[model samples]
Target: MILFGRVRMLLLRTIAYLIDSFILFILVIAGFQSFLLITGLHPFIGRHLYSISGNELHIWLFASIIIPVYMYFVTMFNTRAQATLGMRAARLQINTTGRIGIGGAMLRALIMLVPWELTHIALSYPKPFWVAHHLQSPLLYIALSLTGIYWLLPLLNLHGKSIHDFITGTIIIRWHMPPTKKP
Candidate 1:
């Protein structure tokens, strides 16, 4: 049996996002471990290759690379693959709410994962360039500075929507489940 467009679309999007968050949580843990070893820093599991209180060079490098990379990875994969690990596991689809194609998903993903926000990633420490370039306003920061404005769109608009949602026509939702639908 078929469900309403709203029901199916909403559920699907939610499932997809949940799957994405769950899988990426693992990726964050596992990826960062590899990130530490490759960069020659010590994970908390060990004594020390060095700590943050030291030169903090690793801090900068990690910030410059890791944060944006994680965002890019999640968005790009979510868009291009047409499904993230969570989405796939939950058996949901994306762009269905927007009723868009895989191509549209990819385009939307790329736009949201702009490269500049990486600058503010360093600000996470507020102490040092140890893991990143200075929060010196890279290209993404400008967009992010504008994010407050965009975020307000969701609040201001009647339906709680954002500019990106308007632009990509994308949103999160829960996928429908099937019952017997028997007579």
Candidate 2:
């Protein structure tokens, strides 16, 4: 029964993450479209921003995605509910051993994003000049391994805690909101 609960929690977490990722994807597309419109309207801004090397473009794109996602995680975790929209949808909450302040939330968010960002780097080919600077690229293997380990971590434990949760001394658990009082 305990193992089953853990498995269910892990599945819920996975679904929650997918939901959040989808939301972020939409937001990123909308943001880029907005930027394109602004740039199209003003050639000067477009010229300055658009004029970048291929490698630099990749970095900029990554930053654009990472920055927003990082901020979202940090903000959501630091909130009273300590859950993102997806987490809420999945009825999940963060249970922290200590006060998980802004700094802790930031660290947790960054750690959680590491495997994902690494996978992106590994998959994006023609190897951005900086990435392919080395004679041999071990990034793909590292990325795949890390991603698999991170994703499988919850299964190894009963509480469904992943690498980020362990690193930050936090746990993700099923939760429910209390009933509101009548006016």
Q: In terms of TM-score, which candidate is strongest?
A: 2
For all candidates, the clash counts are 16, 0
lDDT of 1 by residue, 26-105 (tens): 66656765787778784443544334442254364456455644564445445544555666566654444434564555
Structural RMSD, model 2: 4.3
The 0-to-1 C-alpha lDDT of every candidate, in the order given, reads 0.51, 0.78
TM per candidate = 0.46, 0.80
Best by lDDT: 2
TM-score of 2: 0.80
Clashing residue pairs, backbone N/CA/C < 3 A, model 2: none
For model 2, what is the error of residue 157's alpha carbon versus the real structure, in angstroms, after optimal superposition?
Answer: 1.3
Point out the worst 10-residue segment of candidate 1 by lDDT.
Answer: 115-124
> On a 0 to 1 TM-score scale, where does candidate 1 land against the true structure?
0.46
lDDT of 1: 0.51
Model 2 poorest 10 in a row by lDDT: 42-51
